[model samples]
Target: MKMIKTAFCLGLVWGASAYADPELHFVDLQEFNAALDAIEAGESPLSAMESYVAQASPVFQAYAQRYETSAASIADAYSERPGYYRSLPELEGYIRLREPEIVSALSRLEAMAPAGEVVPTYFMVADQRAGGTPVLAAGAAGPQINIAVAVDMIALTAETDMSEFPGGTGGRAEASDLPQVVIHENAHVLQLAAQGGLEAYRSIYSPEGGNMLAVAVREGCAEYLTYLASGWRLGDRHVYGEANERALWSEFEAVMDAPPFSVPGWFSGRHPDHADWPAQIGYWMGFRICEYHHQSAADSDAAVRDLFTLYRPDDLRPLAEAYGASLSAN
Candidate 1:
């Protein structure tokens, strides 16, 4: 697909980590955009990643620099770069969104944050962790599983939308979906704190680890928090955690039957919502456990704080004790 360049200058850069990475800095819009254009033209997300590593973490720079311009352009061209939509735009935009409506909605939710809730540190590409900015991979939340703390809110989208008009719906995806994507990726930021992310992921999984369950928990928490942040507007992933129960479960019978692709997981199956099938399931279902745990906790803020410690459904069984429920079946 052909990509076009757009004109723009710096407006803002954001992240998930509590403390910004010292190494994740960039030279503002001009230099960053030029570098990013080069990346979208032919650079691999991995190779292009290093150029972005710094106080601002390439993850943030990745989105800030090219996502809107490049990803949208490539998608506009309807190219075959399968990941062109997701890599360049989808994930990053979901994390550091620029849409006006979403921000306005967030402004109205401040009154809901429990005063005592220990707002988990917003996390992002860690300075110590290399291999580019591990935005979605590190994970974060209002609680601790890896490490407990109250997460004020996580941005998650209940998006199950997709298209192939040009750059695939993954880029200019949709508003409802951005929150979940944002929260899930940020959860990875939280993970970096407890396990050094890459190293911990390796230890939990296999030689090719990238622990899918951990990824799900990180993602799930983000989804759950997005709902908490949005006052449950994002929808419940747990109610349909079981594939058989989801509205599209029958259409996607084989979804979530395996782990995520470490090399670069991509699901191409087309359900009613494009390729949003199994991928959406992971984020939603995984989060349900956390949601249940959160609802059951006497002190909701404490539940948020305990979220980081959770890495799986089993981990949640004990956590949900306060709710007198067992998530072992999940």
Candidate 2:
């Protein structure tokens, strides 16, 4: 039996009584890497991939099924995109090199999260199509987080010159920053759990009930909480610099009350013209709202806890308004 190593961070030592460390399971990495190696060796990846999926925890399997297409399709995609397979070794090396820092970051995030809010089962797998941003899917049945890392995307971004890569600007992300990416996704897991699981979360999107504010609130909270957990500000990420954020916020506040459905392009990054706009400006707006709520609260910890529980646009709107007011006052 292969030894599955659990990553652990040594907590603060206070005269010999150290706090309990957070544990993350990376068994999937070992299994998934083996599958990638098989593909590189001119072998069919289906057998190894299926074996891995079969052995995964039920929650993890469900998440994989929910977020990914059929395994056969995934295999075909990898086969067609040989570059994705070629990048596996480098991606694996990156993960291995940063294991210690990644584990420590996870520990710190777990410690910062509210009690009983942590997702225990975490699976990391390879998905050639994910680009640099990892896809996180929370299981509806249990505390599980399934993450798919895009090797080719990461490798392409690592290149100094990205002129040849599609969506190069959007996909650019440092391999060293994977820890913060994981933390950001984990923050979403916490948010999903707080919303009474995935079913309730899906319920909010019903035609009459759905609104752009919901999208902003949901993504914004995750973005803000990610910063709280890892100290990596979303505003500082990607092409969005300080000036970009200020401009976006100014525009967002001007027309925030307009129905989210009316201006779908503004709330979501679907419009082609939005290429010049900061990527996911909605996330930035949402984070500002959460930041305001956090700063206004008498109890910061309690405020964070409540922020995670907010799933309705009505609840989020007031905080956003308050944030806008604060900006005006400043």
Candidate 3:
């Protein structure tokens, strides 16, 4: 229950006096870890899971209800994964080791956040498959964020031990990057708030709608904002390097104006081998567009504010084209 006040500063997008720092509620990872320990010591894993669910924060409870499943089912599924439960102690240790770093990172992010009405609740869980990865993290306007710590630590360790997962890009392995991931997801929370709250944000950006522009705007701006807030890139190595980034932008420009689903294939985790592009290149593309918009704007702060508040995809075309022109000129 550590409460870090929002460090108010002048020149913020929402003004210095606008929003107070939201209370960050860290879940009791120790209790959860002990539950896992009990499971390892021969207690019924499901029973342990049920106890956890009973005591979880409202955000986690909502997450469970959203999937139309009980928390026990979700916990059971995670336990079913090979080496999942066994990894809990190691994961807890990793989190404890990095607690200071995580807090510091969050402080940096909060410093750059706009004043808003919603204060988000933050927590950690043990689901590897919760979002897209075992260490999946997600954020929304309720300002709720959940990180699956154990799975993420395992993945991080695996990546460190091995160069990269088979058919996976092996970048972003350092445990130091964990805070940046949290910042990226927090950026989503801010974005959702900017775009008329959670339901509206989901309607336009959810995968079911397949709105490429929206997805690009949503995710790209999030990644870009994370950089602005934390000075770190969300993904692997290639994106931060100038040469590879320029090439990827050039390719993305060709289809930047394509219809919603026209170039959807390009956004997949599996990128084309011939291009030597990193997976999820769409994130990079959107980031570049937002970057150009920010750099080219008359008021940079306003440009960033618009990134979160603006919902139209077509409005971003000029920004993308401007960036493309600069790339070609170079």
Best by lDDT: 2
Model 3 whole-model lDDT (C-alpha atoms)? 0.53
Q: Write the residue-wise lDDT of candidate 1 on 39-64 in tens digits.
A: 66997544443443333333344433
Q: For model 3, which pairs clash?
A: 128-134
What range of 10 consecutive residues in model 3 has the weakest lDDT sum?
1-10
What TM-score, computed on C-alpha atoms, does each candidate reach?
0.43, 0.70, 0.69
Model 2, residue 264: distance off in Å is 5.8
* Clash count for each candidate, listed in order shown: 57, 0, 1
- Write candidate 2's Cα lDDT for 71-134 as tens digits: 6755665555555444545555666676676666666665655532333334345454343222
RMSD in Å for candidate 1, one decimal? 12.2
lDDT of each: 0.36, 0.54, 0.53
Ranking by TM-score: 2, 3, 1
Across 1-330, the per-residue lDDT of candidate 3 in tens digits comes to 001112211222232333345344456355566667767788787887777777766555544444444656646655555353444435445645665655555565555555333233344454543331111123322233332222333245442423223434333234455555566666665665575443343344433443566666667787787787657775464334355767666666666555554564355534445346554567777777787888888997798787666656566666667877887787
Off by over 4 Å in 3: 1-24, 67-85, 89-118, 131-155, 158-175, 198-202, 206-210, 254-268, 272-276
